[model samples]
Target chain A: MALDMKLFKDVKTIAHAGMDGLIFYFSGEPVQANQRVQQYMLSINHAKPDWLKTLIPSYDSLLVCFDCFKVDAHFVYQYLAAHELTHAVSIDGSHHQIPVWYDSPQANDFEQIKNQTGLDKSEVIKLHTSYSLQVFAVGFAPGFAYMGELPEELVCPRLATPRKKVPQGAVAIAEKQAAIYPFSSPGGWNLLGLCPWYYELTDPGDLPEFSVGDSVSFYAINEKQFTEMANDR
Target chain B: MTDKLPIGFVIEDPGLCAIIVDNGRDSGLDRGFSEGGPLDETAYFWSNWLCGNAEGEPAIECIGSIAFTVKARAAIAVTGPDVTLTRNGNACPSWQTLNVEPGDKVTAKSLSPTAKVYLAMSGKWLLNEVMGSAGTMMREGTGGLDGKGKPLDSGDCIPIRIGDADKKEVPNWLQPDYHSNEPLDVVPGYQFEHFYPLARRRFFSADYTVTSDINRMGYRLNGPAVTSDVQNMRSEGINMGAIQFPQDGQPIIMLRDRQTLGGYPKIGCVAPYDIPRLVQQQVDGVVQFNECAASDARTKWLLAKSKRVRYLTEK
Candidate 1:
C-alpha cells in the first residue's frame, strides 16, 4: 500500500511555525519506515518552493523550520498540501569503502564485541565494510550524520555509560545505526572504526554536500595515512 | 574616517571570565555549535540600560569581577545580582550610570551572591559581529570580538565609541529592580501527555532545587524523581528552555548550549520571560513550575520585553 501524505498536514503546519517546532509521529515498522521517510523527504526537498529553507527527514517524520518573520505557518501548510508526494522508497544504493584500523591497542570495546559476537576481527571488518548504507539524517553534534541498518549480527546496544569525549573521525555504532564523529565530543556509541571526512560548516552560500537520501560508504586507513590527512588539513 | 575614542573603565575587578554579549547566533546548531552569551538575560539587559545602550546592544557579561583603567571619559552602569562597584576604591551604586575621568580605575567586586553580572557602556564596543551576534560560543570556537569565543582578560584593551561624556545620572524610574523572585512559567509540550499521568501530577506538584551543576549548556535539577517507564525515544530537535527528564528521572532544563536535539521526553519549556528567573536561581534554591497558557504567555513576554526596551531608552 502507498503511504498517505495527507495524514501529516497538521504536523507540517505546526512544524512551519518556526517557534518551538513540531515533531510528527508516523506509525510503521522502525527500520523499513525510517528509510522510506528519508526518501520521501528527498522528493519533498526536490519539489520544495524556492522560499523554503530546508526540509529535514528523521526516523519517522520530517522537520521543516522557516523564518517566522517572513512566512507564517498557514502558508507552509498550504504549500505542503498542494505538492503531491511520492511514496517513500529506498533507491538502489552504491557503497564507498571506509578503511578502518580496528587493530589499535586503544580499541576499548574491540575485544568485548569479539567476545560477544564470536566473530574474528577480520570477519567483523568484512561485515561492516561490505554493506551499503544511507545517510539517515544529520543531527546530534554539528555535521554529525546518522547512517544505518547494520547487519543484525553487528547491531548492539549503546554502552551503559558514554565516554567523556569520543575523538573526531571515530566511527561508532549504537543499535542498528552506524555514525562517524565529525568533531570530538562525548557520546555513548560503541567505537568500531574512524573516518577522515570533514563536514563543512553551513555557509549561507554553499550547497549541502550530503542530504537525507544520499548513499555513504566508509574506508579505513592506516595510522600513517590518518596522521598525514590530519596534517594536510 | 574619524578616529573613534575608547571610552569606559572597570571599577571593581572582573575576576575571571568576562566578555561583551548581545543576542546570540541564530543558526549553526546543525554543525554542533553551542550558543555562548550572558547566562542571565535580565541582568544583561539592566547592564545595557545602565550604560545607556539600547536593548540588544553589546554589554559586558562579568562572570567574576572586572576592573579596568578608563582611557576616555564615558558613562557606564553595572547591573545583575550580588555585584558591588567601586570607583578609585570608593563604593558605587548599581543600576545607575557613573561618569569617570580618563584615568579613573573602575573595579567590580566578585558577585557576593550571583554567578554572573552585566556592565554596559554608553557607546557601542568595537568588536566584529559573527553569525549575527556579538555573543560568544566558545565551544564551537566562534563569535565574540575576534570570533573565537575568548573572554575578556586582563591587559586586553577594548575600544568603545564615545558619546556624551556629560550624561551621568540614571533616572530613578529607569533603574530596574534587579531582584525578582517568582516561579518560572512553563508551557507544556506536545509530549506532555506521553508520560504516565501519575508522574505528570508529581512533576507539577513537586518543588525542584537547582543543583550546582549549572552552566550555559543546562541546569540539572535535584528533586523528587520525575520518572517515566518510557526509556527509549528517538532523538528530536529541542528548544531553549526544554525540561528534559533523562532516564535518571531527574529533570534537566536545557539552556543555550544544549544539544540541538535530544531523545529524552520533555515535559515542557519555561517561557522566555521566565528564563531569567532560572538563570538567577542559585545552588540549593527551590523553584516551583507554573503552567501558563501559550497565548497569554507570548503576550506577557512581548510586553515585558517592550518594557525592558523602554527602560533602556529612558534618560
Candidate 2:
C-alpha cells in the first residue's frame, strides 16, 4: 500500500528504521520539519497506543519506536498513513529564560571563541542571548539541548581536538547551534560560560526542563549570583 | 519490618565491568537517554528465568571476572559465552539455578572481553527505578543500585528480597547458541538506496570483523567501507541496531546505549533478533550482513519474543 499523498505532503519517506522502529523523513526547512515532527508526536500521543514506545524528534525526521511483538513496521506505516496528523492539537511550550555566568573561570574557550568570531567577550554573550532560540534537538547526552539559529557572527567551528572533559553546565556553541552540557562529558563545542541551570535525572518522572521546539533565552549573570543560585537549588 | 531487612550478595571482586540492569527504560529517548540494558539480552533473560524471577527483573551484567558473597540463602543463575562458574572453589554449571548458603562465594569468569555474563538472583532486587527502569545508563548517570549508574565494585552490597526459588534449568532446546557464525540480518532503511549499488553489494558480501573498539554504546566493525552518496545530511534520531556508514565507510551498529541522535548516513538497521549474535561475537570474530525484508524481520522478532514468553509461562 502507498502512503496517502494528501496526508504525507511533508513526509519524504515513511520507511522502516529497524525491526522495532519507523522513521518519517520530512522535506522542507528545519522549521517545517520540526512542525511535521510535532504534528506526528501530538497525533500519536493522543491515541496513546500500547505498542507505541518512544518518539524521537530530530532536525529533519521523526523516529517512532514500537513494541515489535505487537506490531510490525507495516502496521505502523499504515497507522501513520491513516492518522490525520494535520488536525493534531497544537499547544504552546514553556519559555525558559536561563542565566549564564559568562567570563567565568570555566569559560576556558572564551578567548578562543573571541578570536574565531572576531567579537569581544561581552559581545559574544550579547549575540548569544540577543534573541530567543528554539531547541532543534536534544541528544549526545542527557539534557544536552541543541538550540539553534545562533547569530551568524557567533558561528564558530568545533575544536579540531575535543577536550577529554567538559564541565557540566558548560554553555557552548558550534556551527549554527548553542547548547549546555548537562553532564561533564567530552565535547568539542566552544565554551562561552557556564549556566546555573542543569538537568538531573532523579525520578522516573524526571525529564529535561526543555523539549524540542521550546523557546530558550539566556541572560548574563555574575559568578556570585551563579554560585548563590546553584547553592539554592 | 523484620522481613524488610536487607538480604542479598556483596561483590567481592567486580572484575572488568559490572552493572545492574533490567528490561530497560521505554521513555527518555526524547530527552537524549539511550535505552540502556543488558547487551546480550537473550542470556540476561535466561539468567533471570532460571532464578524464577520475572524476565525483566534487575540482574547483574558483568564482563571478565566477578566474584560475590551471599549474605542469605538464595538461588542464582549465570549465563554467558565461554563463562566458567565456580562456587567456593568448586566448578559449578551455568544456565541452571544454584542454591547458595550464607557466606558462600560465587565467581563467574569470562575468558573473552567481547562477551558478557549475566547473574540473576531469586526475589526482587531493591533498586529505585529511574524512568521506569533500573537498567543502568553509565553515560547518563541514571539507574542502578545507587541510581548513579556506577558499575558494581568490590564490597558493594546489593539488597534484594530473599525468597525460596525452586531448582530450575533452561531447557536445551531454548538455550541460545553463542557460537553460531550465521550472517546477521539487516533491514535496510534511511538513506539505504542513496548508497551506490556496488557499495550495497559490498556491504552484504564483505566480511566484517568485530573490532576491539566495542562497548554498550556501539560496535565498530572493521570491514569494506561502504560509502553513501548522500551528503550534508542533517543529524537525526538513531534507532537501536542502526547500521551507520560514516565518511570512512566502515559500518557502526548503534546499540542500546547509542546517543539519541547522529548525523552519519545509515544504510539500515540490524534485525533485533540478530543483535544478540552480534553482541556475543568475540573481538575479531568475522560477521557478515544479509538483507532482510522488514516484514520478515518483524516476524522473526515476534517469534523470538513469543517463544520467550511461552517458555516463561510454561515452565
Candidate 3:
C-alpha cells in the first residue's frame, strides 16, 4: 500500500468547514476518492501532526479539524507541503453481504419507484442485488451508509414529496446513491425494502461493518426470512 | 413521609420539547453518533454554574411552559432567554439560583421576546448513555433514559442524585449578558468566493432574521437570498456553525445535531463563540454577520473558553 504524498500536491481547493475545520476537496469517483481520503488520514495519523484534532472522510473530501489555539490553517498547508510523510496502511477489504427483504409491505415507495424506473418489482430487486457496491460514505443519520452508483437501470428520482417517516432498516435509493435507514427518519429516497437484522455490526476483530472502503451486496429474502431474522436479532 | 427522605421532581407537564440533556461530549461519530448537546451553550453553562453542577452535567432544557412538582427541597437555576418563571403562583427571577420546597410546583412559560430556558437542578440527572451521550436525539430514536428518543411527557420522574441543602449563586462578574446586538462573527467558509462579490458584501452587511423553524439540528436564517455560482458541489463533512446556502439562497446555520455531511454551498461558518447567542435568538429577531479571519476567530474562541474555565476554577 504505497501512497504518494505528492498526490496531494495540487491541493486546488480547500474549504473552511468551520473556523477550526477545513475540507480538502478531491476529484475522483466515490470509491477511489474515499479510499484516498482514508489513506490521507492514515498518513496524518502516522505523522501525529500536533495541531490535528479530528479527521472526517466524506465522498470526495477529507475534513480536518485542528487546535486553533496552537496552529492556524496556514500552518497546516505549509506543514503539509514542507513535510514528506507518505505511508499507507493496508485497508481492510471485505464485502458485507446483507439480506434484504425487498418489496415488503413496509417498503412504502416500491410501487412508485417501479413506475418511475419502468422496472417491475422483481427486476428492480435483481438490479439492486446484482451490483457489489462500495460503502461510499455514511451520514445524514447514524449508521446510514450511502452506497453508490446504483445500476443506471435502477436510477430513479426521489419521491417528489418525502415521506414523514421512513422506517428503520429501510433500503432506499435516490439519484446515484442507496442507503439503509439506521433509524426511522423523514426522508425522500425511494424505499426498496428493509435489511434483515442489519444493524450496529457486532463483529469483532475489525472495524464496524460500514467503513468507507468496505463493499456491500444485498440479497433478496422473503417476508418469512425477514421476520425470522428480525426475531433472532 | 419525612423531610429527610430524598424526593425527585415529578414532571407535571413536559412543555414544548422539554427533555433531559447533558454536555453530551462525544467522539463516536466514526460509529455514527453525532455529539448532541445543548442548543444554547451560555444558558447551559450558566444554569449548571448557578445550580452548583459542573460543566456538562445533566439538566432539563425546557422550550416553553414546563411545570414540575418538587418532592423534596432542591436548588434550581432557570437560565436562558428572559423567560417568565413562577413557583407556587409567585414570580421569580431567572439567570440565578432558586429553591424548590416539597409539594412546590415550579413552572416556566415563554420568553415571548425570547427563545428557550434551561431548568438546571442542583442534583445531576442520571441516565444511561446510549452512545457516549445523554442528549435525546429524537430523530435517531436513541439516547435519554428511555433509550427510545421519547420526549419528556407528563408523569415522568427525572432521576437525579440528591444534593445537600447548600445552594450556590453565579457571581455577578461571571453572569453572562445573554442579550447583545453586536455583530455575529462569521469565519469565511470554503465556498465564500463562489458567491458574487456583491452578494458576499450584502451577506456581511445585511440584517438576517431568525426563522421560527429553529431546532437543535440547525437554524434557518431569513434574510437575503444570496446565491452561489457553483451549482452542484459534492457533499462534504459538516461541523457545527457551518452556514449553508440552499437553492432558495437563504442561509441555514448548522448546529449541534447537524448532519455529518451536507452538499449545499457554504457562505461561511458563524463563529463558535457567537453560536450560543445565535441559537437563542427569538424568531424574527434581527442579526448581522461580521466576517473575521480564522486566526482571529480562534483567538477569541480560546479567550472565551479560558475565561469560563478561570471563573469556574478560581472561586
Candidate 4:
C-alpha cells in the first residue's frame, strides 16, 4: 500500500534545497507527543514498502535519510506527508521498565542532587526512581539514549565542570533530560544513578535492544543484581 | 585460514601518532554510529591512489613521521602535509608509488607546514574490520586492527597482504600541488541568519587563524569573535567542517572525529573539497571563508572527483 503522498512535502522542500538530510519537527500535546512519533516510525518500518529507505523518529523530531541514488527526495517526502495525515492518533502502550542502581556510590551526581533539592539522599532517590521517563532521543554516544521529563523537584542542571570520565552505565540528568551513558566517556550531565543494563555494543547478530519510541522506566536494583548482570555477560 | 595473511606493521619508532585506518565503518549512524575516517582526507585519497589500492583499503595515517622496517617487499605510497620521506637514507618523492625492498627502512619526517600524513599500500592490509571499518575511533574504542582504538606503538608489526607484480605509475597531472594553500568554501547553515549582520559580514571577509587545539575531533580557531544575537538552541546533527560559534564567539570547525551532534549555533559547513586545506593548516595560519552556491560546490566536487578518477585509471 502506498503511504499518503502529501505527508512528504517537507521532505521534498528540503531535498529540493539540496540538503543531504532533514529534521522533521513534530508537535503534539505533551501527554501523547512521544508515543505519536514512535508509532509513526514503527508503522512505516513494519510496512516495509519498497520506496522507503530509513525512517528515524526521536522525541520531537524525525530524521529521514533517503537513498538519493534510488529514490528522489520528493518521493520520500510524499510518503511521510501521506503517512502523517492518515495516522494522526497516538500509538500508546509500548513501554519498558529498565532496572537502575540509584543507591550505588558510582551514581556520580547523588550528593549534588541532595544538596540542590534540599532533600535528603532517600528523598532524591525516591523521586528519581518513581518517575517513568519517555525516551526523548537516542544520540550523543552510540546506544546512549536520552530519556526525560524528570520530576520537577529532581530537576537539576549539569555539573559546572563536566567530569573527564563518566563511567559506562552512568545515569545522569541535565536540565529536564535523564540519560544512561552506554559507554564510558567524558560527559557533563549531572549524575543521579547507574543502570545495570547494557544499552550499546551488542554482539553481532544480536537484536538491538532499544528502539527510538520505547519508554524505559527505571527500577532500583541492588548491588547483587548489578554484579550478577555484569558477570552474566 | 592459510590464505588469510596477517596484517601487521613493525614500528621502528612510532611517529607522533601513526595508526592503521580504512574507510571508516558505516556506524549505521541512521542507528547512531559516527562516521570516523582519517583527519586529513585529501592526503588519505592520494595515499590510496599511490598504491592503486581500492577506496577503503586499510592504510597508515601517520601524524608526524613513521619509521618502519618492512619484513617483505611491498609497493607503498606516502601522502599528506609536507613531509620528507627516505628509504634507507635515500630521499624519495612524496605522492608517488615506490617498491620497498624487504628489510628496507622507511622513515617519514614531520610536516614542515602541514598537520598530518598518509601512507597506503596495495592489497588489503591483513587487519580485522571492526564495525565494518578499519579506521580507528579511539574515543569509542571501536574500529582499527583490534577494535580498540589505539595509536601504533614501538615494535608493533603490521602484516600486509602481498599483491601480484602489477605496477602502475602516478601521472604528474594527478599530483596535487601541496604548496597551493587555499581558503575553504562554506555554505551557510540554518543558524547563519541568526548571527548579527555585522558578524556575518565579518565572517566572510575577515581572516581567522587556526589554533593548535586541532585534532581529529575539531579545529579551534583564533580570530575576532563572530558574535551572534541568537540564544542557545537545541543541539543538532553537525556535518563535517561545521563552523560552530560557541559562547566565546570564536568559531570551532568540527572535523572527522567530531561528535555526532552538537547544540552550538553553526554558521554553515565547509565544502568537502576544502576540508583538506583546513585540516592541513598549521597552527596560527590565517584562513578565510568564501560562500559559494551549492550547485557550484557540487560541480567543483564532480570535477575534482573526475580528475582523481582519471589520475587513478591513467597509470
* DockQ of each candidate relative to the true complex: 0.23, 0.47, 0.38, 0.21
Instruction: Highest TM-score: give the candidate number.
Output: 2
Q: Which docking band does candidate 4 fall into?
A: incorrect
Residue pairs in steric clash, candidate 2? A204-B131
TM-score of each model, paired residue for residue: 0.77, 0.86, 0.82, 0.80
lDDT of 4 at B260: 64
- How does candidate 1 fare on TM-score? 0.77
Candidate 1 chain B has its poorest 10 consecutive residues by lDDT at B1-10
TM-score attained by model 2: 0.86
Q: Which stretches of candidate 1 lie over 4 Å from their true place?
A: A1-7, A10-20, A25-99, A103-127, A151-163, A196-211, B1-14, B30-32, B110-114, B164-181, B229-232, B306-315
In candidate 3, what are the lDDT values of residues A1-233, reduced to their tens digit? 01122435534467666788877776666666666676677688778877886676777777788877788777776666565648653557688888888757887576787787889888888898889887777777777787887887888765544465787788888777778876666666788888766533332112235877778888988888887887776
Superposed model 2: Cα runs more than 4 Å off: A1-7, A86-131, A151-166, A173-175, A186-208, A218-233, B1-4, B306-315
lDDT at position B35, candidate 3: 65
> Could you tell me the lDDT of residue B13 within candidate 3?
84
The DockQ for candidate 4, computed on C-alphas, is 0.21
Model 2, residue B243: distance off in Å is: 2.2
Better of 3 and 4 by DockQ: 3
Number of the top candidate by lDDT?
2
A1-233 in candidate 1: lDDT tens per residue?
A: 01122545323313211233333454565555566556556566677654554444565655555443345444555566565666557556454455565554444466666765776667777878878777666666656667776788886656544465786667887666777766666666778865544323223223224445567766666777765665564
Give the per-residue lDDT digits (tens) of candidate 1, residues B1-315.
Answer: 113535354333446567667866555554444445567776776666556676688877766567888877788777766668888789988766788778788877545444577777778777777656777655555566556667666766666776653345445443333355566787776367667888888888788998877767788898888765544455566667888786667888888766665566687778767777677777788888887654456667667766756764563
For candidate 3, write residues B85-198 as lDDT tens digits.
889999998776788888998988866534667888887666777667788877666776576667888887777776753556665555445578999999887688888999
